[model samples]
Target: LEFLQKPWHNGRLLRSKGYFWLASRHLEIGLLAQSGKQFQWDYVGRWWNFIEPSQWPRDEYRLQGIMAKWDSVVGDCRQELVFIGQGLDTRVLQRELDHCLLSAQEIAAGPLAWQALPAATAFDTEALSARPTPPMAVQPT
Candidate 1:
């Protein structure tokens, strides 16, 4: 009976269709990708329709939502923004490809990385300045 209280508050009034989830997901990454998180390969695929040339509607809709949000924030500059959107799209596609190429099962079945194991990354800080700075001599000492 409480559902009658407000049309906006009810979960039933809300939708369950997961197609729109991309829009929300896109918002989180689109801006970051545009800002230079270019190597992100994690968000490449949400559906298993990779063999098809057609894009998933959710993916398309997600990009549109990203564009919409970008437009709202930076308006009246169509030409420049279109180029930016294209760049973003390219980055996202590259990420998907990278993810696919890295997974070995996708390569054979266990995931691509599992098949051709990549070398572990070195985390040493040898690149940083190791020389210790001498304390400035006391003014009058």
Candidate 2:
């Protein structure tokens, strides 16, 4: 809701019968509620750089080698997001995000502690897909 309050905010938040998706850019930060019960935040900072098709390894073994070589971090679990907008307040945004990150103590607390966070409500996916679509009216000649 804080994001909607922004003066330059011009985007839509769509909620289907059983689906939720965000299609926005320019610092819109689209949020999606998975199955209306849980929010999937898996792709926070992980991304792949452009690699030429010709340069790509031909085999699985070679592919793994290339991935390891190019990726400084052994595992590809890092945050890397791009923000594009006019009159953007980068510092404020970064500071807010930094504050939300897990502290050293929190990280050490383990997954059990993290699971205690709030949960989302579940919705009926079948009902959403089975909903009827309106037919177009025929024009008279």
Candidate 3:
């Protein structure tokens, strides 16, 4: 998984004046392994999305928040995400993501080669379920 923030021209931070233009200027990339009843594939292509936090309603649940609590194992295991935004250039995004996929040559190199690719930081899923719960205090009936 990868999270990317669109950098402003000259690398300036988005300012108040650019709020509307930059509100949804973020990208999420995911990679998922495919499985069938009796077989599993190495990896499958997934989609990307542009996210706009500003447009979400106050009470609406956002993937960012939900993702924060994701169990790394399962969360890190799938390549799936929703791009949230407005007026996004789907073509540009698609082209960029396509560049990240493994080429036929890379795929032929096998699992060891695939594992050598650079990857972003991922959540620690094993720790998710391993956390101990707080004990409940006794209460009057």
Candidate 4:
């Protein structure tokens, strides 16, 4: 809907640079909270870099104001915002929107790790075999 209201850039409406930057910050924080995976995927380090030590309270205000409250979980909406900030293309934009939306919902509900994705044993042989792997080392031909 936000995209529809304005020219589509990257699932974003192409606002000013500052707006996009702010949106990126918001989006990043939201993604971190939702996926239980921070941008750097740190154990103890800060996941959302935008919220500085002094900015924590400000974040709380923005979170409430921007996300529409715990019911909305604004923190989970950062990926789309960042994608827009970085200016992804149109199809990319829609795809991003779809993905970020799901991430947001997952975050809103609970942590992503707690939710089960199928384990290797849960799939058929081929499906299990599809697991990503490091490429075989090739020497001289």
Give the top-scoring candidate (TM-score).
Answer: 2
Model 2 lDDT on a 0 to 1 scale: 0.33
TM-score order of candidates, best first?
2, 3, 4, 1
Ordered list by lDDT, greatest first: 2, 3, 4, 1
Q: Could you tell me how far off, in angstroms, the CA of residue 44 lies in candidate 1 after the best superposition?
A: 14
- What candidate 2 gets wrong by more than 4 Å, as runs, is 1-74, 119-141
Quantify all predictions' global Cα lDDT against the true fold: 0.25, 0.33, 0.31, 0.31
Writing each residue's lDDT as its tens digit, candidate 2 over 10-95 gives 22222212211111111111122333233232111111233334654478875665466345532222233444445556677577
Model 2: clashing residue pairs? 37-120, 45-78, 45-79, 45-80
Q: RMSD per prediction, one decimal?
A: 25.0, 14.6, 17.9, 15.2
lDDT score, candidate 1: 0.25
**Deviation in Å, model 3, residue 53 alpha carbon:** 40
Q: Record all residue pairs in model 3 with backbone atoms less than 3 Å apart, i.e. clashing.
A: 31-79, 32-79, 49-83, 50-84, 51-84, 72-125, 73-125
lDDT of 2 at 133: 28
Where's the lowest-lDDT run of ten residues in candidate 4? 17-26
Question: Please, what are the lDDT tens digits per residue for candidate 1 over residues 1-141?
Answer: 121122331112111111211111221111112232222111222222212224323476654543453344322111111122322345553453244232333335432333233221110121113323222211100
Model 1 worst lDDT run, 10 consecutive residues? 119-128
Off by over 4 Å in 1: 1-32, 36-83, 86-106, 111-116, 119-141
Ranked by TM-score, the better of candidates 2 and 4 is: 2
Q: Would you estimate the TM-scores of all the predictions?
A: 0.17, 0.38, 0.33, 0.24
After TM-score superposition, the amount by which residue 94's alpha carbon in candidate 2 deviates from its true location, in angstroms, is 0.6
